[model samples]
Target: MKTQIEQIKVKNFRLYRDLHITDLQRLNVFLGANGSGKTTFFKVFNFLSTCLKDNVTVAVNREGGFKELITRNSDPEKNFIEFEIKFRNFEQGEKSPLVTYHLKIGFNHGKVFIDKEVLKYRRGQRGKPWHFLDYSKGIGSAIKNEQDYDPKSKEIREDQPLGAEDILALKGLGQFERYKTIKSFRTLLEQWLVSNLQNEEMRKIGDVGADQQLSMSGNNLAQVASFIHEYHPDIFQTILTKMKQRVPGIDKVDIAINEAGQILLKFGDNSFTAPFISKYTSDGTIKMFAYLVLLHDPTPRPLLCIEEPENYLYPTLLRELAAELREYAVRGGQVFVSTHSPDFVDALQIEELFLVKKEQNQGCSHIFSAKKYDDGQISELYDNGCELGWLWQHDYFKGINP
Candidate 1:
């Protein structure tokens, strides 16, 4: 069964004081003007998903944390941010179970405390009582008495930690045996895997590690290409076959480790001969190869979030990339993309697209579903031969108070 994110809600985090999003489809495209908090929203979900993974928390704090991460001037004592995820279970009649996971921290009397932490599971829709794994309250005070005969004697006592019952409940899942499957699956999601793309310069090096998992910055393109060619030969051949259809004369892509242990991509002819260096290859050629390799690799389905995939590509290729993404969605993978390119947005349907805008005075952000608009409004513009981008800019989405 395919497991995919169904919804995400965040509160009191960054530029978002409160945000709720629903109707999550396989392919979600976030479209908005610059500085409208598109990247911030993406970071929220990424952080939420990766918090328990080692090094992710530190990376998130470096980006911004409790001091700089939360809303400004919000109650220092009461400020807390929460994240909730809903997952669709393909085995159970496509029923999606909503999981409300929360992490709350605050400062009190010059000390930082994790005020509340919980992972609650709800079988179905809203109003359903949730089954919880962890829950906590605040610290408690203890009374101290000493030296009953000595009136001047003084003694110190420590306070007990909060949520004893909840802690036992989670720990008891194994020994006491409660909700074993749900607890184990929740742990899996917390440790979800990530694979990234390589950078342009590293792709030129032709090093062994260059074929390593693509870094978030896509700095290891060469190594990734190398790894794909060496180990996953079938996947590599599939990508080459697809790319050949688009770019003529591209017979095969090969990656070789040189005398200095550097990785190199060799583009051969129809007859397939010596591995020519890839540095001489054009930027479009490199980018296309990277996309093909990433898409064809049969790794576990993850939340593939990409930024500005249309960058450094010809207009014709942008349409091709969009079509590829749609095919990816149909294959049961979840994709979230943020783009300013009109060609990218026009390639998707109104239902598959979302327009993000910031609300004034509130300093909060919201997403507008383009599909909610009447069909007549969409058809009228389509019949007039208006492109999706032009309609959004001039007719349907312009001049509405955010």
Candidate 2:
């Protein structure tokens, strides 16, 4: 089954004391003021991906260690930084059961370790959920032959001990094919993209090559653009055609190699005899093209987390960009976006929007779906000819402080 996250619960992670969000749509947009934890929410995905790629300790350290990473005023001795993601696979078949992956990281004696990590699924509606992989600290076991395991019969297991307490169990067990669920989940984590695109980085010349995926900062935009142009010409042409429609004079986007053999991204204009290099392209054009390249990838990432994509782009183009993001989600990839733009919110459906706000007293963040907020008045306003962005700017989304 194609993997898609249905729900997420986070506890004692930075400003999120206990945030539980359900009924997640394929295209999820987070709207909030600064310090409302929108970036922190995206970091959760980055942290999880890092843990799988490296280790829990490395991930924690990358975020300035446990003290800075955990919630404020929380007792480290008692509380654990926890995350729970409930997702289901649809590629295997529609009958695939919901699967939950839970991880708890604790700090003890100035050292970080996995307090508890679990991946479980119920094969049948009547039976107990099977723990495909279970681990705490460095020791754990995974069920062998999980693909054909019958809950009624005794399940075979193996004691797979990780080299270190901070090591993720999925990092080890995901290698074997027998653990189908674990392997898929691990692959999903490894492929999830969290973009923090820097326009300056996108314009920089880079080594020549075909990079199927975009980097976090999009410094490799030229390479990825080259990749699509060479390997997937149809997709590349679609991107160019879309660009021409969006940008006033953009006729084509091409690649060039400098004398140093570095790849220089180029843009063609209908009025100009010569193409414009990325260095001379406007920020909005470079940023928009980078996004088109990312969204048009033939093999989309299982999950994509992008923060503030409205930056650099013209406000008039935000609605269209938002639509493109939604279309990408419709193509089997889950997307999480944080935006401060009213134009972008105006393009979102109530179910696709979430408001992140913080309590004045508790100083912790909470997420409320736009569909269920304020007794459904937001939906009422939306239905009564009020745009979501206008409602937000006029303080209709209470406590948003935007």
Candidate 3:
């Protein structure tokens, strides 16, 4: 089954209180100045995936406990941090159906607990979505036989006294194959990655191995580069060709084994007869190459979150990077990028773009589509041959403009 989360609803979480983004395209670009909750938005996925790694308690603790995670002016009535994700799940030979997973977390004495968790989907073309996996305060039931049937009707449900509130029901049922939908959803969540790549790590010699996927810090960049070469030569060759095309005088990319049995990245330039090791490579070259190693993986992750991809690259390379991200989307992978580069935004469509900002009066920050502002004048800019990046660079999209 192929799945991608299409919508996010957050309440009392970080700077977001009662926020929802419904229309999510495969490729999403978040444009905002610093301290506008862009990285906080990315942390939403990070938090959920962390929940899968352990429990909500551990996940909450990892981020300095629940108080640090919840919004400062959090609603008094809403004691729990809530997150809801709507996903389009495409099962074998079936039209993709919208599946929603909701979680509410509460904290007590610095301990986090799952206040409420529900996973459901609409049974037919219309009606209330059926809750296949529903649990509250560590006790509830799940519809075992999740085959095509009326979940609204009284179907066979298995009573599962899930041990504790802190432990997620999705975590428990996901381990059993009998809970097919639960397992698939868990696997999908587990596949999500939030990338905060470190340039220094990419520059260093990495472990002598080929990771199935790139690490969050990209410490395995060399191994991933070597991996594609040894396992997927076609992908590696394509990356090399792109590297040469994007980076001037980059003719080849080699993966060499060090005396210590570690993997290193070596680049060849036409000017030099000998290839220069990664230590000598430009920062931009290594960053771009690492991105290729990630985006071109044979088993692409269902969801990817990258922060400021334009960090070390030249402005001209932003367009090429954006194109590759779109290609990843075209291949059915969902990518979310938070970038401040207008050059990168210039390559994105208005529908694929979002503006995030903080309002003093409201005392919160949130993300919104261009359609929500100036009666949809944002799209008109594109019609008038003015790209989103240009308008944003000129401070046009932040507020309504003539």
Model 1 off-target regions past 4 Å? 55-60, 91-93, 109-113, 123-132, 137-206, 209-213, 268-276, 373-387, 399-402
Clashes of 1: 19
Off by over 4 Å in 3: 75-78, 92-94, 126-128, 150-154, 400-402
RMSD values, in order shown:
10.0, 1.3, 2.2
Pairs of residues at least 3 apart in sequence or in different chains that clash in candidate 3: none
lDDT of all predictions: 0.61, 0.91, 0.84
- Against the true structure, candidate 2 reaches a TM-score of 0.97
Q: How should the candidates be ordered by TM-score, best one leading?
A: 2, 3, 1
Ten-residue stretch with the least lDDT total in model 1: 142-151
User: Taking the tens digit of each residue's C-alpha lDDT, what string does model 2 give over 1-402?
Assistant: 257898999999999999999989999999989998999999999999999999999999999989999999998877899999999888878767789999999999999999999999875778888899999989999998675777586667889998999999999899988888899899899999999899999988899887899999999999999999989999999999999999999998877788999988789998999998998899999999999999998998899999899998999999999899999998978999999999999998889999999887998999999999999999998888898999998999888994
Over 4 Å off, model 2: 150-153
lDDT of 1 by residue, 1-402 (tens): 355676777777777777777878878888877767788887775564444442233534655556677776687567766666666555445544455555665545644444555555543343433434444443432212221212233333334454432132222232322343344434435433233333455355744673445556555777776777778888778888877876667887766777998766787756545645667666667777777765664553455677777776777777788888777766756677888787877788766777777776677777766665444576466557776676766647642323
Clashes of 3: 0
Q: How many angstroms is residue 185 displaced in model 1 relative to the true structure, after the best TM-score fit? A: 5.9
Against the hidden true structure, what lDDT does model 2 obtain? Answer: 0.91
Please provide TM-scores, in order, for all candidate models, with all chains considered together: 0.77, 0.97, 0.95
